[model samples]
Target: MGVLLDSFGPALWLVLSPTNLVIMVLGIIAGTILGALPGFGAAQALALMFPFTFGMTPEAGVLFFIAIYAAAEYGGSIPAILIRTPGTSAAAITVLDGYPMARAGKASRALKISLYTGVVGSIASSFIFLFAASGLAWIGLQFGPSEMFAVGIFGLSVIGSFFGDSPVKGFVATGIGLFLAMIGSSGFSGLRFTFGQASLLDGMPLIVVIIGFLAMPEVFRLMAARRGDDPEVASLGGENREANHVGLKVMRKLVPTMVRSTLIGTAVGAIPGPGATVSSLLAYSEEKRFSKHPEKFGTGIDEGVAAPETANNAVVAGSLIPSLALGVPGSGAIAILLGLLISKGIVPGPLLFQQNGPLVMAVFAGLIVSAVLMLVVGIAGVRVFALVARVPRYMLAPFVLMLLVIGTYAYHNYAAHIVIAILIGAFAYWLETIRVPVIPIVLAFVMAPIIEANLNRAMVIHGGDLSFALTRPITLIILGLAVLSIVLGFFRARRARHESAAAKENLGETP
Candidate 1:
């Protein structure tokens, strides 16, 4: 806590500098554009932009990416409002009220509501993150190897449980990631799965794997999608143009909904799974339940839009809590952020505040600035973002592919990395086709080394006695949590499947 206070001044200075501020604005603009495009999102944007950050100072890069992250959350609602297409998964809930509002000639109102609440949520969430992350870090500092290993296991279990409709598939994907992580030489054991390739000596490059899974597959999905004219965005109605500005009264009225949603988002995000998508869903449902006119939620109301939008944006900061404190990324986009930090030789976790206090503080400051700037940028360039949404997926595909190639190759200037990325990307696309979640794979891969290293250390200290973990209260608690998480995931999956089947059956009988 002292470290945070001591470094915050310098961190603020670094982030507020003119050069870094420019990076923040540009990143917000870029993120907003990409996020407003259907089928593109923060993870893809970050993956594509990875190479460009190589030349930046760590603080600047972190700030830039954080700006993109915050802006993308808001950007996602743009298409949801303008064209009834959710630009990101988190925005799907927004489509409920957003599209209806747009159809009713309230498109501007919906967008502004999303923008304003998103900024407020993000800023508020960042503050929660500031205190919460530091506290988590302090707790983590007390964890031994056994506890840390258990924590890692808990993270993977929770992530797997929440990833897809079926925990089975999610676990399978996690296994695949674990296998991929085992490819390099295990300092104690010789090469496990390198297959005699010298390049495998260092294991899979995080950059290449990240690009393959997050960026390339998106391009594949885009290009493989059936060719057609792009969906046209509905025009902003004349009345909407005349009354686009959201009055302060509307903002005042939705404050409670925004506050509730922000809290929900922060809590859920700190748990290391579910992320903005689930948070938004939960927030929207809760708001409906709390609303005076619940029936009007999907029919288009300010509260409906505010609730989900606020939650999803708040998730931008909330998701970082676990990532910064526990070295466990909450989502794929967060994995990218941690990957960058690692590449810069800045390890995340409890010690990070001690070793890189200023940098960590910079991240916190950057998040706040980005949240504020996202609102400004969103308001100024909304029309342009709406037009960008009209771009054909096919046209965007080639450019994205080019970026995938360039970014992958630039990481190490290794041609093999490009080939590996292509193969992994193709594999990822196949997995997607089978409804297998890719994010669990990324999370597990990122966590594998940490888990393995800690588990090995724990074993060495305990003379290979697994029973020692049973004696450690912290380790036992974490392991118990992991078990509970898996159980919960199984039930959630079963319930989701039942609900889906029922919905389909009802649809079939409707007409």
Candidate 2:
């Protein structure tokens, strides 16, 4: 206890420094702006900023990125509510009801609810981080290659469960992502895929692929669908002011949703790959299931805003578990962070905790501070940001596309990457039109390599006995859970279909 307290004290002091606080504020502001803009995402922001961190200490750089990540999640709600355009993929769930509320002139109220719920959820999840991180670290240290592979499989399965209404589409996205991930050189034999191009030798850059799939295509879509009209922002004056004012009563009402979503977010975040989008969607669905008036969900209820906002923010803390402990990135942002850590000579594995205990503790402290800072910044700037929603898509779209191009090229000074980003963006937009969820693809891209590497290692060690994956008790338990998740999802889908059929039957009878 004494040693732990001593370690924590210095970490708290490091983050409490005025310089660090200022950086946190700047990161949150910058991230919020990027998140509010269309075609910009947290991953791109991190990739762009990653080079700048080369000069800073690992602790400071990591903290800066965490600040951006946390703020971006909250910032996404701005565009989601105001324009029906999600600033981040995770914010897509917010648009289901948030845009409706905004159209009804309750944009201010929706923004306030999102801000408050995000803060509460972040704080709640940080506590989970504080308590669970060390234990998870200890457990992760014992995982063999086979166990890790199983964990990766479990993560991929979770993605299938969390994506859109069609499980087949989710699996298809995952398969494509995994196939794309295999494009680079094979880790074992040094053989290359789609051989012949020098650029293909190093395999596709994760940044390039992510940017292509997520950012570039959105730019073209925005341009093609360009509308001159601006969205209306709810003013803070008169009745809107009264409605927007967040009070104790509102907080109390939202508390249940916040708590539930936070729990769901933490659990999903703790998983290996699905990250915030899955967590937010799961939380949103759960909220709908539990709501007294489920019909109001997509009509812009505060509960709708609160549930997803809270879950997304909570995911920030949860993602850190695997990254900090086992060197596995829980999400895209964490993957970037892992790369940054590697560049800084900080290898993140079990040894990380032993060698960099103080630094690890410092990061944990910084995460807590970032959460608090998000709340402060979010509340103070809510009105101004809400108004940013009124910016015309015509103007915003071009600026976002330019930023995407610049950020992509700036990463490796490669113009090819910019082209790649454009191609990916165009493809992603088409995929969206076809109702394919991007989350599974993104997650599969992130996890497939890890899974392949670990599985190959495990097989070599066990003389090709694949059963080693289940030989370990913990791995078996995880696999069990994965199977259970599939079963549950199947039943849930069936129940939803039955409910829809019954509703139609009742309507027919009434007519």
Query: Top lDDT: which candidate number?
Result: 1
Residue 210, model 2: lDDT of 56
lDDT of 2 by residue, 1-511 (tens): 2344457878889888888888777888888887765545688678767776777777788888888888888887887786555667788678777877876667778888888888888778877776677665455456667777776787677667646566678778888889888886786777556567666666667656655675555566556654644333223122456766779999998888998999888877776656677677678867876887765766778898999899999888887877877887877789998898888899998787677777777777877888788878877887776665555556567776776677567667877667666766777888988998765776677678878888888889999888886678978987887787666656666777798899999999995
- Per-model clash counts, in order, read 0, 5
TM-score, each model? 0.61, 0.74
Model 1 spans with C-alpha error above 4 angstroms = 1-118, 129-137, 225-367, 461-463, 496-511
| Per-residue lDDT over 369-399 for candidate 1, one digit per residue giving the tens place of the 0 to 100 score | 9988887877776566444344456666786
Local accuracy by lDDT, each model: 0.78, 0.75
Ten-residue segment with the worst summed lDDT in candidate 1?
229-238
lDDT, candidate 1, at 357: 86
Worst-scoring 10-residue span by lDDT in model 2: 229-238
> lDDT of model 1 at residue 244?
58
